[model samples]
Target: MTASLKRFAATLWQADGRRFPAPLSLLLVGPLVIGLCVAFILPVGRLLAVSVWNPDFTLAEFVHITESPLYLRILGRTFLLGGVVTVLTLVLAYPVAFLMARLSGWRLAVATACVLVPLWTSVLVRSYAWIIILQRNGLLNSILTGLGLTDAPLPLLYNELSVTIAMTHVLLPYMILPIWAALRTIPRDLPLAAQSLGANAVRVFFLVVLPLSLPGVASGVLMVFILSLGFYVTPALVGGPETLMVATLIGQQTTELLNWPFAGALAALLLGITLLLVTVFNRFLGLDKKAAS
Candidate 1:
Protein backbone atom coordinates (compact mmCIF):
# COMPACT_ATOMS: atom_id res chain seq x y z
CA MET A 1 0.00 0.00 0.00
CA THR A 2 2.80 2.43 0.81
CA ALA A 3 4.58 1.71 -2.48
CA SER A 4 1.36 2.28 -4.44
CA LEU A 5 0.61 5.61 -2.57
CA LYS A 6 4.14 6.86 -3.27
CA ARG A 7 3.78 6.05 -6.96
CA PHE A 8 0.40 7.82 -7.11
CA ALA A 9 1.75 10.96 -5.39
CA ALA A 10 4.69 11.15 -7.77
CA THR A 11 2.39 10.78 -10.79
CA LEU A 12 0.01 13.48 -9.51
CA TRP A 13 2.83 15.99 -8.83
CA GLN A 14 4.32 15.35 -12.27
CA ALA A 15 0.96 15.66 -14.03
CA ASP A 16 0.37 19.32 -13.03
CA GLY A 17 3.98 20.37 -12.16
CA ARG A 18 2.68 23.04 -9.72
CA ARG A 19 3.75 24.20 -6.23
CA PHE A 20 2.76 21.98 -3.26
CA PRO A 21 0.96 24.77 -1.33
CA ALA A 22 -1.46 25.72 -4.15
CA PRO A 23 -3.55 22.52 -4.12
CA LEU A 24 -3.65 22.41 -0.33
CA SER A 25 -4.77 26.07 -0.27
CA LEU A 26 -7.71 25.36 -2.60
CA LEU A 27 -8.67 22.26 -0.63
CA LEU A 28 -8.72 24.29 2.62
CA VAL A 29 -10.75 27.24 1.25
CA GLY A 30 -13.29 25.40 -0.95
CA PRO A 31 -15.42 24.21 1.97
CA LEU A 32 -15.53 27.68 3.56
CA VAL A 33 -16.68 29.31 0.31
CA ILE A 34 -19.33 26.67 -0.23
CA GLY A 35 -20.57 26.97 3.32
CA LEU A 36 -20.87 30.77 3.10
CA CYS A 37 -22.82 30.57 -0.16
CA VAL A 38 -25.18 27.95 1.20
CA ALA A 39 -25.78 29.70 4.53
CA PHE A 40 -25.90 33.42 3.75
CA ILE A 41 -25.87 34.04 0.01
CA LEU A 42 -28.64 31.63 -0.94
CA PRO A 43 -31.02 32.85 1.76
CA VAL A 44 -30.38 36.52 0.88
CA GLY A 45 -30.91 35.77 -2.81
CA ARG A 46 -34.27 34.10 -2.10
CA LEU A 47 -35.30 37.13 0.00
CA LEU A 48 -34.45 39.49 -2.84
CA ALA A 49 -36.33 37.30 -5.28
CA VAL A 50 -39.43 37.35 -3.11
CA SER A 51 -39.19 41.11 -2.52
CA VAL A 52 -38.95 42.26 -6.13
CA TRP A 53 -40.75 39.38 -7.83
CA ASN A 54 -43.80 37.66 -6.47
CA PRO A 55 -45.44 34.57 -7.86
CA ASP A 56 -44.73 34.13 -11.59
CA PHE A 57 -41.87 36.67 -11.47
CA THR A 58 -43.89 39.91 -11.29
CA LEU A 59 -42.75 43.29 -9.85
CA ALA A 60 -46.04 43.78 -8.07
CA GLU A 61 -44.60 43.53 -4.55
CA PHE A 62 -41.97 46.17 -5.27
CA VAL A 63 -44.60 48.48 -6.70
CA HIS A 64 -46.94 47.84 -3.80
CA ILE A 65 -44.31 48.69 -1.22
CA THR A 66 -42.67 51.64 -2.98
CA GLU A 67 -45.80 53.40 -4.25
CA SER A 68 -47.71 53.39 -0.99
CA PRO A 69 -47.46 56.53 1.14
CA LEU A 70 -47.73 54.44 4.30
CA TYR A 71 -44.78 52.27 3.36
CA LEU A 72 -42.80 55.37 2.38
CA ARG A 73 -43.61 56.99 5.69
CA ILE A 74 -42.46 53.94 7.61
CA LEU A 75 -39.30 53.76 5.56
CA GLY A 76 -38.59 57.44 6.18
CA ARG A 77 -39.19 56.98 9.89
CA THR A 78 -36.86 53.98 10.05
CA PHE A 79 -34.10 55.96 8.40
CA LEU A 80 -34.67 58.90 10.70
CA LEU A 81 -34.49 56.69 13.78
CA GLY A 82 -31.29 55.07 12.57
CA GLY A 83 -29.74 58.47 11.78
CA VAL A 84 -30.63 59.91 15.17
CA VAL A 85 -29.31 56.87 17.01
CA THR A 86 -26.06 56.89 15.05
CA VAL A 87 -25.45 60.56 15.81
CA LEU A 88 -26.33 60.14 19.48
CA THR A 89 -24.10 57.08 19.83
CA LEU A 90 -21.22 59.00 18.33
CA VAL A 91 -21.70 61.88 20.73
CA LEU A 92 -22.00 59.54 23.70
CA ALA A 93 -19.31 57.02 22.77
CA TYR A 94 -16.60 59.51 21.77
CA PRO A 95 -15.83 60.64 25.31
CA VAL A 96 -15.90 57.07 26.59
CA ALA A 97 -13.58 55.97 23.80
CA PHE A 98 -11.22 58.92 24.42
CA LEU A 99 -11.01 58.05 28.09
CA MET A 100 -10.39 54.40 27.34
CA ALA A 101 -7.56 55.26 24.98
CA ARG A 102 -5.87 57.48 27.56
CA LEU A 103 -6.18 55.17 30.54
CA SER A 104 -3.85 52.33 31.60
CA GLY A 105 -3.58 49.21 33.80
CA TRP A 106 -6.47 48.70 36.22
CA ARG A 107 -8.14 51.93 35.17
CA LEU A 108 -8.30 50.71 31.55
CA ALA A 109 -9.67 47.32 32.55
CA VAL A 110 -12.27 48.86 34.87
CA ALA A 111 -13.41 51.30 32.25
CA THR A 112 -13.62 48.54 29.63
CA ALA A 113 -15.62 46.43 32.05
CA CYS A 114 -17.95 49.32 32.63
CA VAL A 115 -18.56 49.58 28.90
CA LEU A 116 -19.01 45.83 28.39
CA VAL A 117 -20.96 44.94 31.55
CA PRO A 118 -24.14 46.49 30.18
CA LEU A 119 -23.63 44.63 26.91
CA TRP A 120 -23.33 41.34 28.75
CA THR A 121 -26.75 41.97 30.30
CA SER A 122 -29.85 40.95 28.38
CA VAL A 123 -31.50 43.60 26.22
CA LEU A 124 -34.96 42.43 27.29
CA VAL A 125 -34.04 42.85 30.93
CA ARG A 126 -32.62 46.30 30.27
CA SER A 127 -35.70 47.37 28.32
CA TYR A 128 -38.01 46.16 31.07
CA ALA A 129 -35.84 47.86 33.66
CA TRP A 130 -36.20 51.09 31.72
CA ILE A 131 -39.95 50.49 31.61
CA ILE A 132 -40.11 50.12 35.39
CA ILE A 133 -38.10 53.28 35.87
CA LEU A 134 -39.94 55.33 33.29
CA GLN A 135 -43.52 54.29 34.11
CA ARG A 136 -46.01 56.90 35.36
CA ASN A 137 -45.61 55.90 38.98
CA GLY A 138 -42.07 54.69 38.64
CA LEU A 139 -38.72 55.64 40.15
CA LEU A 140 -38.28 58.71 37.98
CA ASN A 141 -41.58 60.14 39.09
CA SER A 142 -40.84 59.37 42.71
CA ILE A 143 -37.51 61.13 42.47
CA LEU A 144 -39.11 64.11 40.75
CA THR A 145 -41.77 64.36 43.45
CA GLY A 146 -39.17 64.20 46.16
CA LEU A 147 -37.27 67.06 44.49
CA GLY A 148 -40.50 69.15 44.24
CA LEU A 149 -40.06 69.27 40.47
CA THR A 150 -43.68 68.34 39.61
CA ASP A 151 -47.04 67.78 41.26
CA ALA A 152 -47.63 64.39 39.67
CA PRO A 153 -46.04 61.57 37.71
CA LEU A 154 -45.18 62.29 34.08
CA PRO A 155 -45.55 60.05 31.03
CA LEU A 156 -42.08 58.89 30.02
CA LEU A 157 -42.43 55.35 28.74
CA TYR A 158 -43.97 54.30 25.39
CA ASN A 159 -42.66 57.24 23.40
CA GLU A 160 -40.03 58.13 20.78
CA LEU A 161 -37.66 59.54 23.39
CA SER A 162 -37.69 56.29 25.32
CA VAL A 163 -37.02 54.31 22.18
CA THR A 164 -34.09 56.53 21.25
CA ILE A 165 -32.58 56.38 24.71
CA ALA A 166 -32.91 52.60 24.96
CA MET A 167 -31.40 52.05 21.53
CA THR A 168 -28.50 54.38 22.30
CA HIS A 169 -27.78 52.38 25.42
CA VAL A 170 -28.07 49.04 23.67
CA LEU A 171 -25.86 50.02 20.73
CA LEU A 172 -23.33 52.11 22.63
CA PRO A 173 -20.66 49.40 22.90
CA TYR A 174 -20.55 48.78 19.17
CA MET A 175 -19.62 52.42 18.66
CA ILE A 176 -17.10 52.62 21.52
CA LEU A 177 -14.86 49.56 21.05
CA PRO A 178 -13.87 50.27 17.48
CA ILE A 179 -13.21 53.96 18.11
CA TRP A 180 -11.16 53.06 21.17
CA ALA A 181 -9.01 50.66 19.15
CA ALA A 182 -8.39 53.31 16.52
CA LEU A 183 -7.56 55.94 19.09
CA ARG A 184 -5.17 53.56 20.81
CA THR A 185 -3.20 52.99 17.61
CA ILE A 186 -2.37 56.67 17.40
CA PRO A 187 1.11 57.46 18.79
CA ARG A 188 1.16 59.55 21.99
CA ASP A 189 3.95 61.62 20.47
CA LEU A 190 1.69 62.94 17.76
CA PRO A 191 -0.39 64.85 20.31
CA LEU A 192 2.74 66.05 22.11
CA ALA A 193 4.22 67.18 18.77
CA ALA A 194 1.05 69.12 18.02
CA GLN A 195 1.24 70.74 21.43
CA SER A 196 4.87 71.73 20.88
CA LEU A 197 3.84 73.29 17.58
CA GLY A 198 1.41 75.59 19.50
CA ALA A 199 -1.84 73.65 18.94
CA ASN A 200 -4.30 73.39 21.82
CA ALA A 201 -5.55 69.97 22.99
CA VAL A 202 -8.90 70.36 21.27
CA ARG A 203 -7.23 71.58 18.09
CA VAL A 204 -4.77 68.69 18.18
CA PHE A 205 -7.49 66.12 18.69
CA PHE A 206 -9.80 67.52 16.03
CA LEU A 207 -7.05 68.08 13.48
CA VAL A 208 -4.57 65.27 14.08
CA VAL A 209 -6.07 62.38 16.01
CA LEU A 210 -9.69 62.45 14.85
CA PRO A 211 -8.94 62.28 11.13
CA LEU A 212 -6.51 59.41 11.53
CA SER A 213 -8.92 57.46 13.70
CA LEU A 214 -11.87 58.23 11.43
CA PRO A 215 -11.84 54.85 9.73
CA GLY A 216 -12.70 53.10 12.98
CA VAL A 217 -15.35 55.69 13.88
CA ALA A 218 -16.88 55.41 10.43
CA SER A 219 -16.89 51.61 10.63
CA GLY A 220 -18.56 51.68 14.05
CA VAL A 221 -21.17 54.22 12.91
CA LEU A 222 -21.97 52.07 9.89
CA MET A 223 -22.55 49.01 12.07
CA VAL A 224 -24.63 50.89 14.68
CA PHE A 225 -26.75 52.63 12.05
CA ILE A 226 -27.49 49.42 10.17
CA LEU A 227 -28.24 47.53 13.37
CA SER A 228 -30.53 50.36 14.50
CA LEU A 229 -32.53 50.08 11.29
CA GLY A 230 -33.60 46.53 12.12
CA PHE A 231 -34.14 47.02 15.86
CA TYR A 232 -37.55 45.72 16.96
CA VAL A 233 -37.64 44.78 20.63
CA THR A 234 -36.72 48.10 22.26
CA PRO A 235 -39.11 50.11 20.14
CA ALA A 236 -41.84 47.55 20.57
CA LEU A 237 -41.54 47.37 24.34
CA VAL A 238 -40.73 50.99 25.11
CA GLY A 239 -42.30 53.04 22.32
CA GLY A 240 -45.46 50.90 21.92
CA PRO A 241 -47.71 51.29 18.89
CA GLU A 242 -46.97 54.93 18.23
CA THR A 243 -43.31 54.26 17.36
CA LEU A 244 -43.44 51.28 15.01
CA MET A 245 -40.27 50.54 13.07
CA VAL A 246 -40.06 48.58 9.83
CA ALA A 247 -38.91 45.45 11.64
CA THR A 248 -42.08 45.49 13.71
CA LEU A 249 -44.10 46.07 10.57
CA ILE A 250 -42.43 43.07 8.99
CA GLY A 251 -43.15 40.97 12.05
CA GLN A 252 -46.77 42.00 12.07
CA GLN A 253 -47.15 41.16 8.39
CA THR A 254 -45.48 37.79 8.78
CA THR A 255 -47.13 36.56 11.98
CA GLU A 256 -50.36 38.46 12.57
CA LEU A 257 -51.41 39.40 9.07
CA LEU A 258 -50.16 36.14 7.47
CA ASN A 259 -48.64 38.08 4.60
CA TRP A 260 -45.31 36.38 3.97
CA PRO A 261 -44.74 38.05 0.62
CA PHE A 262 -44.90 41.56 2.04
CA ALA A 263 -42.72 40.59 4.98
CA GLY A 264 -40.14 39.02 2.69
CA ALA A 265 -40.21 42.10 0.50
CA LEU A 266 -39.67 44.38 3.45
CA ALA A 267 -36.81 42.26 4.73
CA ALA A 268 -35.23 42.25 1.31
CA LEU A 269 -35.51 46.04 1.03
CA LEU A 270 -33.77 46.41 4.41
CA LEU A 271 -30.99 44.01 3.43
CA GLY A 272 -30.39 45.87 0.17
CA ILE A 273 -30.23 49.28 1.85
CA THR A 274 -27.80 48.01 4.49
CA LEU A 275 -25.55 46.34 1.93
CA LEU A 276 -25.49 49.47 -0.22
CA LEU A 277 -24.52 51.66 2.71
CA VAL A 278 -21.79 49.26 3.84
CA THR A 279 -20.43 49.09 0.32
CA VAL A 280 -20.33 52.88 0.12
CA PHE A 281 -18.49 53.03 3.45
CA ASN A 282 -15.96 50.44 2.32
CA ARG A 283 -15.37 52.43 -0.85
CA PHE A 284 -15.07 55.86 0.75
CA LEU A 285 -13.17 55.03 3.95
CA GLY A 286 -10.67 52.50 2.63
CA LEU A 287 -12.16 49.94 5.02
CA ASP A 288 -10.09 47.18 3.47
CA LYS A 289 -6.90 49.11 4.10
CA LYS A 290 -7.75 49.93 7.69
CA ALA A 291 -8.84 46.37 8.37
CA ALA A 292 -5.68 44.89 6.86
CA SER A 293 -3.45 47.26 8.78
Candidate 2:
Protein backbone atom coordinates (compact mmCIF):
# COMPACT_ATOMS: atom_id res chain seq x y z
CA MET A 1 0.00 0.00 0.00
CA THR A 2 2.81 2.40 1.00
CA ALA A 3 4.83 1.59 -2.17
CA SER A 4 1.78 2.24 -4.41
CA LEU A 5 1.15 5.58 -2.73
CA LYS A 6 4.84 6.56 -3.10
CA ARG A 7 4.77 5.67 -6.82
CA PHE A 8 1.59 7.78 -7.32
CA ALA A 9 3.11 10.75 -5.43
CA ALA A 10 6.36 10.51 -7.48
CA THR A 11 4.44 10.51 -10.80
CA LEU A 12 2.57 13.68 -9.74
CA TRP A 13 5.80 15.60 -9.03
CA GLN A 14 8.40 14.45 -11.55
CA ALA A 15 8.36 15.13 -15.29
CA ASP A 16 12.02 14.09 -15.89
CA GLY A 17 13.31 13.26 -12.37
CA ARG A 18 12.96 16.92 -11.29
CA ARG A 19 10.48 17.26 -8.39
CA PHE A 20 8.43 20.41 -7.89
CA PRO A 21 8.49 21.20 -4.15
CA ALA A 22 4.82 22.22 -4.07
CA PRO A 23 2.43 19.28 -4.25
CA LEU A 24 0.03 18.94 -7.20
CA SER A 25 -2.94 19.13 -4.85
CA LEU A 26 -1.79 22.57 -3.68
CA LEU A 27 -1.55 23.71 -7.29
CA LEU A 28 -5.08 22.43 -7.91
CA VAL A 29 -6.49 24.18 -4.83
CA GLY A 30 -4.59 27.46 -5.48
CA PRO A 31 -7.33 28.98 -7.63
CA LEU A 32 -9.99 28.16 -5.05
CA VAL A 33 -7.88 29.76 -2.26
CA ILE A 34 -7.30 32.89 -4.35
CA GLY A 35 -11.02 33.09 -5.19
CA LEU A 36 -11.98 32.86 -1.53
CA CYS A 37 -9.55 35.61 -0.52
CA VAL A 38 -10.77 37.89 -3.28
CA ALA A 39 -14.48 37.21 -2.79
CA PHE A 40 -14.87 36.88 0.98
CA ILE A 41 -11.75 38.01 2.89
CA LEU A 42 -10.93 41.23 1.02
CA PRO A 43 -14.51 42.49 1.08
CA VAL A 44 -14.89 41.74 4.79
CA GLY A 45 -11.52 43.37 5.51
CA ARG A 46 -12.65 46.52 3.71
CA LEU A 47 -15.94 46.52 5.64
CA LEU A 48 -14.03 46.31 8.96
CA ALA A 49 -11.72 49.13 7.87
CA VAL A 50 -14.66 51.29 6.88
CA SER A 51 -16.22 50.78 10.27
CA VAL A 52 -13.08 52.02 12.05
CA TRP A 53 -11.57 54.55 9.63
CA ASN A 54 -13.44 57.27 7.75
CA PRO A 55 -10.46 58.35 5.59
CA ASP A 56 -8.67 58.72 8.95
CA PHE A 57 -8.77 56.34 11.91
CA THR A 58 -11.89 56.94 14.01
CA LEU A 59 -13.81 54.89 16.58
CA ALA A 60 -16.95 57.04 16.47
CA GLU A 61 -19.08 54.46 14.64
CA PHE A 62 -18.36 51.75 17.18
CA VAL A 63 -18.79 54.23 20.03
CA HIS A 64 -22.14 55.41 18.73
CA ILE A 65 -23.39 51.81 18.62
CA THR A 66 -22.10 51.05 22.11
CA GLU A 67 -23.43 54.23 23.66
CA SER A 68 -26.92 53.82 22.28
CA PRO A 69 -29.07 50.98 23.62
CA LEU A 70 -31.12 50.76 20.40
CA TYR A 71 -28.48 49.08 18.23
CA LEU A 72 -27.75 46.55 20.95
CA ARG A 73 -31.45 45.82 21.31
CA ILE A 74 -31.82 45.32 17.60
CA LEU A 75 -28.82 42.97 17.61
CA GLY A 76 -30.38 40.93 20.37
CA ARG A 77 -33.69 40.86 18.55
CA THR A 78 -31.99 39.60 15.39
CA PHE A 79 -30.35 36.72 17.29
CA LEU A 80 -33.59 35.93 19.10
CA LEU A 81 -35.49 35.90 15.84
CA GLY A 82 -32.88 33.59 14.33
CA GLY A 83 -33.11 31.23 17.29
CA VAL A 84 -36.90 31.06 17.14
CA VAL A 85 -36.97 30.39 13.43
CA THR A 86 -34.31 27.69 13.80
CA VAL A 87 -36.24 25.84 16.50
CA LEU A 88 -39.53 26.01 14.61
CA THR A 89 -37.97 24.68 11.43
CA LEU A 90 -36.23 21.85 13.28
CA VAL A 91 -39.49 20.72 14.89
CA LEU A 92 -41.41 20.88 11.64
CA ALA A 93 -38.72 19.43 9.38
CA TYR A 94 -37.58 16.44 11.44
CA PRO A 95 -40.78 14.50 10.93
CA VAL A 96 -40.96 15.43 7.25
CA ALA A 97 -37.37 14.42 6.61
CA PHE A 98 -37.85 11.21 8.53
CA LEU A 99 -40.88 10.43 6.38
CA MET A 100 -38.88 11.19 3.23
CA ALA A 101 -36.05 8.93 4.38
CA ARG A 102 -38.32 6.05 5.30
CA LEU A 103 -40.50 5.98 2.21
CA SER A 104 -39.87 4.66 -1.29
CA GLY A 105 -41.51 4.62 -4.78
CA TRP A 106 -44.14 7.26 -5.59
CA ARG A 107 -44.69 8.11 -1.94
CA LEU A 108 -41.07 9.20 -1.62
CA ALA A 109 -41.40 11.23 -4.79
CA VAL A 110 -44.49 13.01 -3.45
CA ALA A 111 -42.78 13.69 -0.12
CA THR A 112 -39.67 14.98 -1.90
CA ALA A 113 -41.80 17.21 -4.10
CA CYS A 114 -43.59 18.66 -1.11
CA VAL A 115 -40.25 19.64 0.44
CA LEU A 116 -38.61 20.97 -2.77
CA VAL A 117 -41.42 22.71 -4.67
CA PRO A 118 -41.36 25.64 -2.26
CA LEU A 119 -37.65 26.08 -2.87
CA TRP A 120 -38.12 26.63 -6.60
CA THR A 121 -40.87 29.11 -5.78
CA SER A 122 -39.63 32.66 -5.35
CA VAL A 123 -39.14 34.15 -1.89
CA LEU A 124 -41.16 37.25 -2.74
CA VAL A 125 -44.08 35.11 -3.84
CA ARG A 126 -44.00 33.10 -0.64
CA SER A 127 -43.84 36.18 1.57
CA TYR A 128 -46.74 37.73 -0.32
CA ALA A 129 -48.72 34.52 0.10
CA TRP A 130 -48.21 34.80 3.87
CA ILE A 131 -49.41 38.39 3.73
CA ILE A 132 -52.60 37.30 1.97
CA ILE A 133 -53.27 34.55 4.50
CA LEU A 134 -52.34 36.67 7.52
CA GLN A 135 -53.67 40.14 6.69
CA ARG A 136 -56.79 41.61 8.28
CA ASN A 137 -59.97 40.46 6.42
CA GLY A 138 -57.71 37.92 4.69
CA LEU A 139 -58.18 34.17 4.33
CA LEU A 140 -57.37 33.30 7.95
CA ASN A 141 -59.54 36.09 9.38
CA SER A 142 -62.31 35.24 6.94
CA ILE A 143 -62.22 31.64 8.08
CA LEU A 144 -62.19 32.68 11.74
CA THR A 145 -65.19 34.98 11.21
CA GLY A 146 -67.10 32.29 9.29
CA LEU A 147 -66.41 29.76 12.03
CA GLY A 148 -67.48 32.34 14.70
CA LEU A 149 -64.12 32.05 16.43
CA THR A 150 -63.90 35.83 16.78
CA ASP A 151 -66.30 38.77 16.69
CA ALA A 152 -63.78 40.74 14.60
CA PRO A 153 -60.61 40.09 12.65
CA LEU A 154 -57.68 39.42 14.91
CA PRO A 155 -54.46 41.38 14.44
CA LEU A 156 -52.19 38.86 12.75
CA LEU A 157 -50.22 40.72 10.14
CA TYR A 158 -47.41 43.27 10.64
CA ASN A 159 -46.11 41.81 13.90
CA GLU A 160 -43.30 39.65 15.24
CA LEU A 161 -45.56 36.62 15.15
CA SER A 162 -46.34 37.11 11.48
CA VAL A 163 -42.66 37.59 10.69
CA THR A 164 -41.72 34.47 12.62
CA ILE A 165 -44.33 32.38 10.82
CA ALA A 166 -43.25 33.56 7.38
CA MET A 167 -39.55 33.13 8.10
CA THR A 168 -40.09 29.65 9.50
CA HIS A 169 -41.99 28.60 6.41
CA VAL A 170 -39.27 29.95 4.14
CA LEU A 171 -36.46 28.27 6.08
CA LEU A 172 -38.11 24.89 6.69
CA PRO A 173 -36.79 23.22 3.55
CA TYR A 174 -33.19 23.98 4.50
CA MET A 175 -33.55 22.05 7.74
CA ILE A 176 -35.42 19.23 5.99
CA LEU A 177 -32.84 18.68 3.24
CA PRO A 178 -29.83 18.28 5.51
CA ILE A 179 -31.65 15.96 7.89
CA TRP A 180 -33.14 13.95 5.05
CA ALA A 181 -29.67 13.50 3.59
CA ALA A 182 -28.36 12.33 6.97
CA LEU A 183 -31.29 10.01 7.64
CA ARG A 184 -31.00 8.60 4.14
CA THR A 185 -27.42 7.53 4.83
CA ILE A 186 -28.27 5.57 8.00
CA PRO A 187 -27.92 1.80 7.67
CA ARG A 188 -31.41 0.34 7.17
CA ASP A 189 -30.63 -2.52 9.55
CA LEU A 190 -29.45 -0.44 12.54
CA PRO A 191 -32.93 0.28 13.87
CA LEU A 192 -34.09 -3.23 13.09
CA ALA A 193 -31.04 -4.68 14.84
CA ALA A 194 -31.79 -2.56 17.89
CA GLN A 195 -35.40 -3.83 17.93
CA SER A 196 -34.16 -7.41 17.87
CA LEU A 197 -31.95 -6.59 20.88
CA GLY A 198 -35.04 -5.64 22.92
CA ALA A 199 -35.05 -1.94 22.09
CA ASN A 200 -38.43 -0.44 21.35
CA ALA A 201 -39.04 2.11 18.56
CA VAL A 202 -38.62 5.08 20.87
CA ARG A 203 -35.45 3.69 22.44
CA VAL A 204 -33.94 2.86 19.05
CA PHE A 205 -34.64 6.41 17.87
CA PHE A 206 -33.42 8.23 21.00
CA LEU A 207 -30.24 6.15 21.18
CA VAL A 208 -29.06 4.84 17.80
CA VAL A 209 -30.90 7.09 15.33
CA LEU A 210 -30.87 10.45 17.09
CA PRO A 211 -27.18 10.32 17.99
CA LEU A 212 -26.22 9.49 14.40
CA SER A 213 -28.39 12.33 13.09
CA LEU A 214 -26.72 15.02 15.23
CA PRO A 215 -24.29 16.22 12.55
CA GLY A 216 -27.21 16.96 10.24
CA VAL A 217 -29.14 18.61 13.05
CA ALA A 218 -26.13 20.76 13.87
CA SER A 219 -25.72 21.76 10.22
CA GLY A 220 -29.41 22.52 9.77
CA VAL A 221 -29.52 24.58 12.98
CA LEU A 222 -26.52 26.65 11.95
CA MET A 223 -27.76 27.24 8.39
CA VAL A 224 -31.31 28.22 9.37
CA PHE A 225 -30.19 30.53 12.18
CA ILE A 226 -27.58 32.33 10.09
CA LEU A 227 -29.95 32.70 7.15
CA SER A 228 -32.66 34.07 9.42
CA LEU A 229 -30.31 36.69 10.87
CA GLY A 230 -29.68 38.10 7.39
CA PHE A 231 -33.33 38.08 6.30
CA TYR A 232 -34.75 41.36 5.03
CA VAL A 233 -37.78 41.07 2.76
CA THR A 234 -39.88 38.66 4.83
CA PRO A 235 -39.52 40.81 7.96
CA ALA A 236 -40.15 44.04 6.07
CA LEU A 237 -43.18 42.65 4.26
CA VAL A 238 -44.82 40.77 7.13
CA GLY A 239 -43.70 42.88 10.09
CA GLY A 240 -44.25 46.45 11.23
CA PRO A 241 -41.54 49.05 11.87
CA GLU A 242 -41.59 48.11 15.56
CA THR A 243 -40.38 44.64 14.56
CA LEU A 244 -36.97 46.07 13.58
CA MET A 245 -34.25 43.54 12.71
CA VAL A 246 -30.55 44.13 12.14
CA ALA A 247 -30.90 43.78 8.35
CA THR A 248 -33.69 46.37 8.21
CA LEU A 249 -31.64 48.67 10.44
CA ILE A 250 -28.62 48.30 8.19
CA GLY A 251 -30.76 49.05 5.15
CA GLN A 252 -32.22 52.13 6.82
CA GLN A 253 -28.76 53.38 7.77
CA THR A 254 -27.38 52.84 4.30
CA THR A 255 -30.18 54.23 2.15
CA GLU A 256 -32.40 56.49 4.24
CA LEU A 257 -29.76 58.00 6.51
CA LEU A 258 -26.77 57.69 4.13
CA ASN A 259 -24.63 56.84 7.14
CA TRP A 260 -22.16 54.47 5.45
CA PRO A 261 -19.67 54.43 8.32
CA PHE A 262 -22.34 53.52 10.85
CA ALA A 263 -23.80 51.04 8.42
CA GLY A 264 -20.41 49.42 8.07
CA ALA A 265 -20.15 49.21 11.83
CA LEU A 266 -23.52 47.47 12.02
CA ALA A 267 -22.56 45.09 9.24
CA ALA A 268 -19.20 44.37 10.85
CA LEU A 269 -20.77 43.73 14.22
CA LEU A 270 -23.28 41.32 12.66
CA LEU A 271 -20.53 39.55 10.75
CA GLY A 272 -18.50 39.25 13.97
CA ILE A 273 -21.43 37.76 15.85
CA THR A 274 -22.11 35.28 13.05
CA LEU A 275 -18.46 34.18 12.95
CA LEU A 276 -18.28 33.89 16.72
CA LEU A 277 -21.40 31.74 16.86
CA VAL A 278 -20.24 29.54 13.96
CA THR A 279 -16.85 29.00 15.60
CA VAL A 280 -18.44 28.13 18.91
CA PHE A 281 -20.97 25.81 17.23
CA ASN A 282 -18.30 23.96 15.24
CA ARG A 283 -16.06 23.65 18.29
CA PHE A 284 -18.80 22.32 20.55
CA LEU A 285 -20.40 20.00 17.99
CA GLY A 286 -17.45 19.18 15.73
CA LEU A 287 -20.00 19.35 12.91
CA ASP A 288 -17.82 19.31 9.81
CA LYS A 289 -15.42 16.66 11.13
CA LYS A 290 -18.26 14.38 12.20
CA ALA A 291 -20.34 15.05 9.09
CA ALA A 292 -17.44 14.13 6.81
CA SER A 293 -16.93 10.83 8.64
Per-candidate TM equals: 0.86, 0.88
**Per-residue alpha-carbon lDDT of candidate 2 for residues 34-151, written as tens digits (9 for 90 to 100):** 9999999998788678788866687889889988998889898899989999999999999999889989999999988988999999999999999999999899999999999999
Query: What are the lDDT scores of the predictions, listed in order?
Result: 0.88, 0.91
The count of residue-pair clashes in candidate 1 stands at 0
Worst 10 residues of 1 by lDDT: 11-20
lDDT of 1 by residue, 26-91 (tens): 777899999999999998787666665645777677679899999988888888999999999999
Model 2 — which ten-residue stretch has the worst lDDT? 14-23
Root-mean-square deviation of each candidate, in angstroms? 4.4, 5.2
**lDDT score, residue 138, model 2?**
95
